[model samples]
Target: MDSRVANDDVSYSSEAAISRWKFAVSRQYQHLLDKSTPHVLHRWIGCFAVACIYVLRVYTVQGFYIVSYGLGIYILNLLIGFLSPQVDPEIHDGPGLPTRGSDEFRPFVRRLPEFKFWYSITKAFCIAFVMTFFSAFDVPVFWPVLLFYWVVLFTLTMRRQISHMIKYRYVPFSFGKQRYNGKRASAESTSLPVD
Candidate 1:
């Protein structure tokens, strides 16, 4: 009975140690993510490198076309979400993109935020890269057909998204655009008139 109790205690302590180690590792992972948040350009460059590596792997293997197709589709979905408004005007008539110059100027809010968009794309590529290593994911198909279809689909989707943007008069991007700071009061306007 004493030996049984001792074994149980040892097992419990080992489990507790494992739990603590996992917690510490997760906390460190989260910390790194937080630290990387502000370096948007760097993060994107890293993601681009990963994508390039994945593409190289697929091209060298000459297989996993299906996985590549799936990744492309997933990326298209992410792009749509990134370009879309949070509250779609077609669905709800609430505060949406201003149709006229007289209307209040509200910044465009995306359905999927930039950070989430980047993270999802990066993660998807990583998953597809991993899938490329396995034989089960390497289904054979005519690569040109898939490529052509993807191009057609992408063109149609972009046309629709552009039309939507034009119809709503909202540009999703803000870089190199004019900014209006409220008019500052002139010194003459504030000065008291001397008799």
Candidate 2:
């Protein structure tokens, strides 16, 4: 009879442990689901809603002004990139150079870079400021809507720029003759193995 009682207690404890484990696993799964589902859905829904709102608002004159302002800012940034000095201070002086035969690629950062980013951003704000004076953006839309649209547009445009940089092996910065020669020397050393 004592052995029978012990067996029942063992079975009951095992069942209780299994139940607790299952509850914990289920809670963990629910937490993951809650976190991930909203993040992915928010990106898609936010994008779609912004597109719909843009289309709906585009018939107004304010939409045109906003678009023109954004375009102007983008153009200014490109011009700055073109005119800025080619030497990258980060590449030239940041750290010790790699050994003569290393296979690593070091990228250059801009030195004395054109203040284009600041100028373009300031220009956009200036345009937006002027637009506010004309009462054009007050077209019965929430300010948050316009802000979200601009943020999305900026993110998408920046992504495209980054993709372009990745696709093209060229860096826009200028390297002096010495840097160029160093790079050539490195290339030659790597192409021919040490005897």
Candidate 3:
């Protein structure tokens, strides 16, 4: 004899209504991304604008407090993401680092995808911009000292990241560069016959 019957109250589906809703939302987001991608240059410009505002505010106030520290932390975080390989060699099949010809067939995938990376940077800048409006964020201290420390921190962090890139045989800007095959198919036709 049949034990179960199909009914709304007696349903045993693995995916609930909430799950379907979430899936629909995700698909909509993916569709939006497919239509167009964000320009990184524009995002960087936004970040620069935010930084300029922060700098101008600090210059007028003559001191930086918690906002400066927050900015430093955010910059360090972004740098770490920028320098590190998105695809970890340990997890993925590779010879510790991406090399030419060793795994040419394998597509280079990043651990930290570009969309999220830029999103975080933009978010940080916006937060800093908002913090500028509040008086409590201002700390009574020599603004020059904070600027000096930021410069020093940036230099050291960048130096270490550059060395890591050199050692690992990877370039973060590989995605940005135009890939050239070093061949000209029309070269032979373009040359006039010597005779």
Candidates ranked by lDDT, best first? 1, 3, 2
- Model 1 scores worst on lDDT over the 10 consecutive residues at 180-189
- The candidate with the higher TM-score, 1 or 2, is 1
For model 1, the local distance difference test gives: 0.91
Runs of candidate 2 with Cα error greater than 4 angstroms are 1-124, 173-195
Per-residue lDDT of model 2, residues 82-195, tens digit only = 533254333446543233445365554443333433334444444554555455554565545666776676677767655645543444555552355788888988897669
Q: Alpha-carbon error at 137 in model 3, in Å?
A: 1.4
Q: What's the candidate order when arranged by decreasing TM-score?
A: 1, 3, 2
Candidate 1 residue-wise lDDT at 128? 95
- 1-195, model 3: which lDDT tens digit per residue? 244454543464535876888999999987865653566676567667877877787668765566877777786877688667776544657556546665553444565677676667666767876777787877677666776888788888889878877766776666575565535646755778888
TM-score computed on alpha carbons, candidate 1: 0.87
State, as a TM-score between 0 and 1, how close model 3 is to the true structure.
Answer: 0.61
Better of 2 and 3 by lDDT: 3
lDDT of 1 at 177: 64
Highest lDDT against the true fold, candidate = 1
Clashing pairs in 3: 86-110, 86-111, 87-111
What's the true lDDT of residue 87 in model 2? 47
